[model samples]
Target: MKTERAISDEFMNALVDDQLDSDEKDYALREANQNTEFRERVCELRALKEMVQHAYPQVADAPPRTRGRTSLRLSHLQSLAACFMLLMIGGTSGWLAHDISSPASDNQMVHSLRALQQNDFGIHPSKYVVHVDTANPIRLKTALDEAENLLTTAQDTSQPSQVEIIANGPGLDLLRTGISPFAQRIALMQKKYPGLDFMACGQTIRKLKEQGIVVELLPHTQVTPSALEQIITRRLKQNWAYIKV
Candidate 1:
C-alpha cells in the first residue's frame, strides 16, 4: 500500500499480473501517465505478459477431449492451463489443485468477489464448473439457463475461456446419445460458447454399460473418470464458481 510515487518493482509486477486493488491500480496508472520512465516500465511489463500468454497458445485452444476416455491424454494440457492461470493470479501458495482426492474451495468472500468481477472484464475469465447430477428436466434446464445467463451477461468486450459443465450420476443422461431431452440444447450452447465444456462421467457410463443400458454420448461430449473429482481438481482448485444442480 505504498504511495503511487513510491511504487516499487513488486507493485509494478503485481499490476502487470492483474493483482492490484482498484484504488492502487488507479494510482499506478496515474503515476505512469505523469512519469515517462514509469510508463515505459509499465509497457515493458505488459509486453512480457503478452509474450508469455502467446507462448502457450496451444494450451488454451487445444481440442476438447472427453473427460472419461481412459486413453485420451489431457492431464498435461489441463496442468499447463492451470499453470498459465497461476501466472495471471500471481501465486502458487494457495488454491486447489486438479486431482481426484483433493480438498475443497477456499475463501468464500474471494469467490463471491471474483464472481461479481467476471461481469466487469474478460481479462481474467470468470470461471464456472457446473454440476449436473440429475436428469430431471427442471434441474437440467436451470443449470443450462444459469450458464447461458453467464455468457450472455459477460462484458461485451471479453471472450471467456474457463467455463465447464460436468455431468455425473443420473445427470450423465443429459449427454447420452438418444434419450436426453437436453441433447439439442447442449449442442446449441456448445456452439455458442467455444470454451464451454460439456462433460460426461466415465464411472456413470461404465455403470450403465454393466446394467445393459445403451450408453452412447453426444459426439462432442468430453468424458472424465469422475465428474465430482474432475470438478474438484480442475475447476474448483482454480477458484471457479461451482454450481450444483
Candidate 2:
C-alpha cells in the first residue's frame, strides 16, 4: 500500500493564503487546531506574507512590463529601486522556505528571517538571551524550560544555539545561594548543559547586602554588573536574540 502523504508546507501555505477550497480548507483548519506544528507554520506563513506585502505593494491597474521592456522611458534610479526590491523578495522568500523545517515541539522560533537578516545573527549557533526579571520561582523554571526548548529546537534545525538567562530585580533569587528555592535544579541543569549560563545581577546583590541579606551565587552562575546592560550588550555587541520572560 502507498504511504499516506503527510500535509506539506505547500498545503499549509495554501491555507494561510486562503487558496484552498472550502472542504480542503476546513480539513486543514481542523488539522491545524490539533497539530501545533501545523498551526505555527500557518502563522509564520501569514506573517511573512504580510511583511512582503507591506514592503512591496503592487500598484492597482499598473501595466505589466514584458522582459526587458518598459512602456515609458526608465530612469536609472527607478531601475535600481526595482532591482533592489526583487533582490530583497528573493532573499527573504528563499531563506524562510529553507530555514524553518522541524516539528513544533522543537521549533519555537517562528520569527521572520527578515528580523535576523537586519542584524548579523542570521546564521547557525544563534545566540539567544533569556531575560527573567520576575521574582516568581515558577516563572524562572518556565523560562529555563523555554530556553532549553529553544536550544533543542535550534539543534533540531541543525544549528547549535547558545542560551543564557539573565535575572535581576526579584528575579535575582533564581541564582542566589541560600534563598533560591530552585538552586538544586539549576545546578543539575548546569551540569547537563555546560554551555548554558545563569547570570546573577550585581546590582541586586549589592542591594541585598545593604539590607543585611547574604547573597551567595550558585556554582556555575556568573555575576554581571547590570542585567539590562548585559542584555543591551548582547543585542548591540553580540547580536543575540533577547527574549524576556
Candidate 3:
C-alpha cells in the first residue's frame, strides 16, 4: 500500500460537516477510500460529532449570552471538549491491521460493545442497540449481521435478549420501504427473531419529506421521534449495549 498522505484536522472536520468544496471533497473522498487510517479518522470524527450532538441536544437551542460571536466560540469549545473525550476513550494507539476477509463484527465498534458487556458492573448484557447512520453498503450489511449475531447468541444460550437496530441520516435508507436492499432479509429476520426490532428516525424522515421525497418504512419497522434520543435516553441510559456501524 502507498503511504497515506496527511490530512489536517480542520480539513477533516469540514469534510465531516459537509462544508468541503467540490475539489476538496473529491480529494477527501478519494483519500478516505484508499487510506485505511484516513477512513478511520473520518469515522472517528463522525462518531465524535454524534456523541456531542446527543450529549447536548439543547445547546443549539440555548439563547446567546452576550454576543453571537461569544456563543459561537462557546459552542466551538464544547465541541473541542467532546472531541477530547472521544480521543481519550479511543486512546492514542496506532491503527490495527484490518483484514477485510474477517467478519465486520470484528471491528473496533464491536470491540467496544464486547468490552462494555464484559465490564458491566450490574447491568445485564441482554439489551443491544445497533446504530447505523451511513449509507455505506458494507456498514449497512454489518449492522444487520451484528444484530442477527447478537440475537442468535442469546437464543442459543437461552438468554432473554432484545435487539434493536436504529437507522438515521443516510442509514435511514436501510429501513426505507423500497430503497432498502435488505428488505426481504429484514422481513425474514423479523420472522426468525421476534425480539429483534427495527427503528427509523422520524427526524430523518421529515427531512427527506421536506426535500420532496416520499418516506415510507418497511412493514413492521417502527419510527422513533429522534434517533439520538432513542439511543441516549431510551437505550444507553437504560443500560443497553451500543454497537455503532
- Candidate 3 differs from the real structure by a C-alpha RMSD in angstroms, to one decimal, of 10.3
Clashing pairs in 1: 66-222, 66-223, 67-222, 67-223, 67-224, 68-223, 68-224, 98-233, 99-233
Question: Can you give the lDDT of residue 110 in candidate 2?
Answer: 25
Write the residue-wise lDDT of candidate 3 on 1-245 in tens digits: 11233388888888788776677877886887799998878877876676666456433545567674444334433433343234323432222222223233223333443344446685748988888888866679989999999999999999999999999889999999889999999999999999999999887888788789999899999999877667654575567876777
Highest TM-score among the candidates is held by which one? 3
15-97 in candidate 1: lDDT tens per residue? Answer: 77667777887788678779988866765675566446535543244355766543534454344333334322332222322
List lDDT for all candidates, in order: 0.64, 0.62, 0.72
Rank by lDDT, highest first: 3, 1, 2
In terms of lDDT, model 1 sits at 0.64
> Which of 2 and 3 is the better model by TM-score?
3
Give the count of colliding residue pairs in each prediction: 9, 0, 0
Q: For candidate 3, which ten residues in a row score worst on lDDT?
A: 92-101
Clash number for model 2?
Answer: 0
What is the lDDT, from 0 to 100, of the residue 19 in candidate 1? 74
Please give me the total number of clashing residue pairs in predicted model 3: 0
How many Å off is the CA of 217 in candidate 3? 0.4
